[model samples]
Target: AVLTKGVTPINFKPEFADADAAEGEDTDPHAFQSVANAKIYVKNIADAFCTADAEGCDTYKANAAVYTEKLDALEGDVRTAIQSVPQEKRVVITSHDAFGYFEKAYGLTFLAPEGVSTESEPSAADVAKLVSQVKQDKAAAVFVENIVNARLIEQIASETGVKVGGTLYSDALSQPDGPASSYIDLMHNNIAQIKGAILGS
Candidate 1:
């Protein structure tokens, strides 16, 4: 229920956790959950404003239109960059299962030894399984997220014989001076890191 494809959002209190749980409700726990998958966010905001003031709503819609265009252009650039790499060299490893949306949108493969959150420590078996997967799939390189410890990824790279790709911004944006300080910059930086590591150009 993380995403409902533009459905109205559900509001609940933390104290009502049990009330939010629905048994037998089929869901993809690992489904893509990112700003990319929430493309309706701006539209929803605009629509909410329309309920208050129609005139002001037009302004929101206009702003959303500009943002949508920027997002489209960003996707195009990322797609082109990924396409430049050979299919066999396109695979990547990250710290966690965060790029499901990007992978589905852009058609690149991403393997992770951890789950969505960095707070949870990955088991040794999980690391071994990911290492085996990296070797079998011939993953291009492993990249550490800015928010996670880099040791695990370095270990994976050491064992898999793949180079450490680079750092990627995951949960939050970096400081203004950092490479991935903005949304568009984050996309460009990630693509540059992956392409540089895989294609070495």
Candidate 2:
């Protein structure tokens, strides 16, 4: 409120069906997890810029077009990579519910103990429930995130008799020397880890 005291913030959060309820719907902010939604976000950004500065509209549109072309290619790559794995084997377990948008867009299932907010802690029952769900769902892989604690994911994997697959960059990119150093790399690295682990298992 303090930061936006004299300005209006444009919100581009994509709404999902089952995720809406009381408490004003626990929306997930990580919409960029999916390239499609990322394109929408880019469009929104471009539109906002054009509205705020008419002289820069053409530049913004041009830049957004160039970038979204790359995003389109990335989308194809993601689909082809994920499609190589069987539909039933596309389940993933992560530290939090950061991949809801990714799951919706990619036809994969992502289970997490904590909700959208990373600060929320799950109870013992919550962890137990997730462990059971992992076993029942035949989860393909359990992954640690660059932004969250890995102990919960490790425990879930251990209980389900699967190893922690790999590190996935969720809310942040990695260092320059790391695998997920950029948005495109982050998506590529995540899908590669998921596909390789699931197929190998």
Candidate 3:
């Protein structure tokens, strides 16, 4: 409808669907994983909106550009913080798998007992295997995600004698007043936590 109407409409995640419901539907979308991805989303939204609504095209483009600049700055800060950790000590274990983008962007190695998504838990045997790997690798730290229960990570920490590094913002953004309200803030908070844990800050 946007293309035909020449006006952009906002899309909200299913998690945010309640907010949409207050307005009306339930949805559980989890597309935005990082600030970089958010920036791309913003650009795409703006372009689509502009193409649909010529009257507000300039405004959309300008706002996207401004927001994208902030995302770039946030990326720089994350890079700087992650770089503070020694490359050899950059390996980290998390309770669930959600750091592929983070690992690719920053120079960290991630190990997870759970598969790529956090929807399911790993088996006891799988956890035991990962525990052994953690010990063999001497991973700098083990982390839990805000969205996942920490019991599994705690057990792994106990078995491996590695302290729980800190919470990593995985599937969702924190509340607006929290440390990870935005995608950039999320990455910055995560990198800072990882560095502090691994580097003894």
Judged by TM-score, which candidate is best?
2
Model 2's TM-score against the true structure = 0.75
Give TM-scores for every candidate, taking all chains together and pairing residue i with residue i: 0.73, 0.75, 0.74
Instruction: Please tell me which model should have the higher lDDT, number 2 or number 3.
Output: 2
TM-score of 3: 0.74
Q: Could you give candidate 1's per-residue lDDT for residues 18-123 as a string of tens digits?
A: 3223322222232212345445665666677777788788788898889878877876788889899998887887765456566666777776553323344557
Residue 84, model 2: lDDT of: 96
Worst 10-residue lDDT window for candidate 2 reads: 1-10
> Please, what is the whole-model Cα lDDT of each candidate in the order they appear?
0.68, 0.74, 0.70
Give candidate 1 misplaced runs (Cα > 4 Å). 1-38, 114-131
The C-alpha stretches of model 2 lying farther than 4 A from their native spots are 1-25, 113-131
**Of 1 and 2, the candidate ranking higher by lDDT:** 2
Report the poorest 10 consecutive residues by lDDT, candidate 3: 1-10
For model 1 the local lDDT of residue 81 reads: 91
C-alpha lDDT of residue 166 in model 2? 84
